[model samples]
Target: MRAAGIPQGTLAAGQERSAGIEAPRGMEEDSGRVKISDIRVKHIDRELDPPFDAAWDPVPRTSFEATLVFVETDTGLTGVGSGDTMAGFAAHAHHFIGEDPLRMVRHVETIESINFHAGRFWPLEVALWDIVGQACGQSVATLFGGTAERLPVYASCGDLKSPDARAESAIALRAEGFRAMKIRIDPRRADEGVAAVRAVRDAVGSDLDIMVDLNQAWRPAGDITRSIDVPAARLIAERLLELDVLWLEEPLKGDDRQGLVDLRRSTGMRVAGGEMAQTFADSLALLQADAYDVYQSDVVLAAGMHRSRQLAELARMRNRSFTPHTWSNGIGLLANLHVAAGVGAGPYLEYPYDPPGWTPERRDFMLAEPLRIDGDGCLPVPQAPGLGIVLDPELR
Candidate 1:
């Protein structure tokens, strides 16, 4: 297989059609042919007892849980994916019940028809891609035209506590082999955000790359009460630049295209956003306007593997950087990792590493083996067919 980022044509010419391995028991016909005879989508709710922190907003404290959507083909092969929702992903499943899991783009568009949808259905789409890749006996990355076997990863910590706590966390993550790290900021006080960065910088020294997430995109009704205005975000970006921050993420609302463009012009630090956006059109608009130095798209949130791949390709055609957001559980991380591995030049994959809440074990609670960062702070792009993740039967 050709390395990721190589032209798709190059990979296609040498791509392995199928491993020639037998399909799972139920998926093969009496003639021994493999075909998708059925599609079943189900939601698995795994709870996070304590809600993750978003200090700027006083939203109700709730459990952290994932609505896992499993696609089971008639052949007995299964592909797994996870979605994000406060009440769980029940509403999103209504649109995916009997659709072809392999026709991912069409599946996503069908689900997008639901009003109030946030593109969470993309996880289901990702699972389908996983299934299709497995059926074809190729890795998901290869399916996306990638041949690379590994990708860089960075630590992403949520919860805004004292600067010292943030600094200590950064140090620990560095010791654990993360070359880069990100910290969430208090949207109400730009100065406090700067101080947090300064403390981490001081603790980790200048060599470690740092990024700050403003999370201004999805301000719930409660956060609206304490949201920072555009001027305040601009000032914060300026200070972040002074601190030598590698990038400033989502300082403006997701839809404030003009504000993002202005912020990029006002600050030297690279500006990043788009995790909350749901379509290729939104990502294209952001890129066309030069809204950010890096594009942050989440596979699960951007409506699945097909659409996220399309966005990454758009970013590449425009000579922009793309790094997927990874705040959800391990399945979400895996889904994005597959996409990033295919993209070739994406920035570090976001690895959620906050302890007491979002540790690798907790984040991957449902999986048999948690994804671990290598000593060099990179994860081997999964070579297994489909998503390359094997869920524990017990966990299921």
Candidate 2:
């Protein structure tokens, strides 16, 4: 990956696909001198036509809401990003108002400290990376360590559908060229969820890899509910293994380190999790405890790209899979895609798709155009500078 201030096409050997790229105009003039001119956060709520049944949310789902973060540089380059609510960030915007956009580490550190009193500030960091990529005339993936411009994607269904419904969706996704599909398993009735997985497997007949998400790692604030215990998780894991599940996701609470470790060891199923891990330290603790076989952290959640890159590298070194959870909005998905591309495709990237309600068009409503999936179930990483997306005027 090209470090800060490094010219394009100068990456060293074995550095994924970096080559034959010209630097942006006036790059030297702008360089590290460009400061953050402004920061804006927008909370958007768009109603979905068909209600999306999110497995974890206790309430009925109708519309989707997201907060977008934009960081504009003094040189006129703007980067776009999205994440959790930024309700507490308006007063703290001055912390980054006049800072250098290219000082990635400094910006990351500042946000890390500011997070104690602030909300999700990683979006700003993502926006800074976006600005740097735009200023350098390169895709953020190239700025990171990615060599490939496209990666295979799996259709990650968000709704808690019935066995028959899930089976039909699986067949449709397979016909659409998706190599894999993820099913959301409701812990309340995990038995039915397992049946749904079985039905999808039988219908697709091994043409696609199946992943099941328990979503047991987290819930809404002020809700201290328990989903499953170790014995119950073991039973579910056994059933999923028998049905040829590729990986079992978030099978227990985020803090159930020993439980996760034991489940992975005993069942031999790839216990995939870490999306709820908010910081590098949290992930480090999980890693130290051998908490998971696959790390599914979201780039927008806590790590962002700065710390996420490190987590991806660590996963690679430890011979573990690093597929990010991309269930958020378009910008958030794109941010995770850049990081996942940088790390190289392990199995498949998460493509949030449950049509009628959670279609790509609705999920990516803020973008100039919806990020469409190809016949081969792959998404071409945007080549345009920054996060490779121009926000819709309506959203702006």
Candidate 3:
């Protein structure tokens, strides 16, 4: 039942347990320990604003931003991580400020205890992993025992008004060297989604790989009224398959494990989800149910580097693709980059590449040097120790 390198056991050894249990082998020693030195959280706000426009979901939006969390070890090495929701970051500061950064597994559990009380402690966990990797003089990927440095990247476009517009954007992204692209589909109408796929496929031709994300996995209901379940998801999937989509992401509610399994079997398109899955148990359950072909673990949501890596390992063992979701911001993208790099080759890295909305400058405003896509569509595995990134002093 233990997924992601976490040891599952009862809180107590039980009354019948004998003294000769022998302290669980490695538990007897606290060797090679490193303590947490400092914790810094930055709330970043971007200058450039972008709109979120799609035929189905037309909501006004501006700025691509996120919260950057840094966990430093006593040895002066630091690790960087990011998250989307920064609502309760202050409350969890005490839980991470003085613990052993190297004991990522222990650190994640301690934070989980605090999470039960206040909720959402994954981002802080990510920062600790960065700290641990730096303390050990390795990239987060190498820390997880992954062999490869570079992984194939796919452009994750945000939103566009028309199918033609989306196609144009895809063409531009392809020119920049992306071999694969994932376009956002109109969740309201199946035909609009179909048109978007057709236009992009025609624009990129049959040679380029494409994926479509429904973003319909979870819809926030503004009122007390029940959330509307869109029946058009199935139809959209059918059309996408005809257009030769590599995969369909978040086609239905994420909690619908049976539905996802059935959808994958029914359509034969790789069903992908798990970006918002908040814990190891949630991911384990999904994997056990055979809910998805690709497991999209987000560093911001998986609660940190240790848990994320653990999820990646689980996915690898199951022969499932582990691609960390990178939509929060630049730091979130970089954090996942380390995790993806560590996962080795095969899975395509998610690169949030919708220009005017998620451009490199606005997305990575805090970093001294933004992580850029190479001419061949691959992002270089950061060579510097730890996360291989530093905050821009100007942003400080």
Worst 10 residues of 2 by lDDT: 19-28
> What is the lDDT for 35 in model 2?
83
Two-way lDDT contest, 2 vs 3, winner: 2
Evaluate candidate 2 by giving its C-alpha RMSD to the native, one decimal: 8.3
| Top-scoring candidate (TM-score) | 2
Q: Model 1 shows how many backbone clashes? A: 6
Report lDDT per candidate.
0.74, 0.84, 0.73
lDDT (C-alpha) at residue 364 in model 2:
85
lDDT by residue for model 3 over 315-378, one digit each (tens)? 8898887787887777778778877787663458898878766677766778887788888889
- Candidate 3: C-alpha RMSD after superposition: 5.0
Better of 1 and 3 by TM-score: 3
Candidate 2 local Cα displacement, residue 130, angstroms:
0.7
lDDT tens digits, residues 136-246, model 2? 888999988866788999889887888999999999899999999999987779789999999999898989999999888988887789769878899999999998899
RMSD for all candidates, in order, please.
8.8, 8.3, 5.0
What TM-score, to 2 decimals, does candidate 3 have?
0.87
Q: Residue 297 deviation, candidate 3, in Å?
A: 1.7
Clashes of each: 6, 1, 5
After superposition on all CA atoms, how large is the RMSD of candidate 1? 8.8
Q: Which pairs in model 1 have colliding backbones?
A: 26-75, 27-75, 48-64, 122-303, 122-304, 149-381
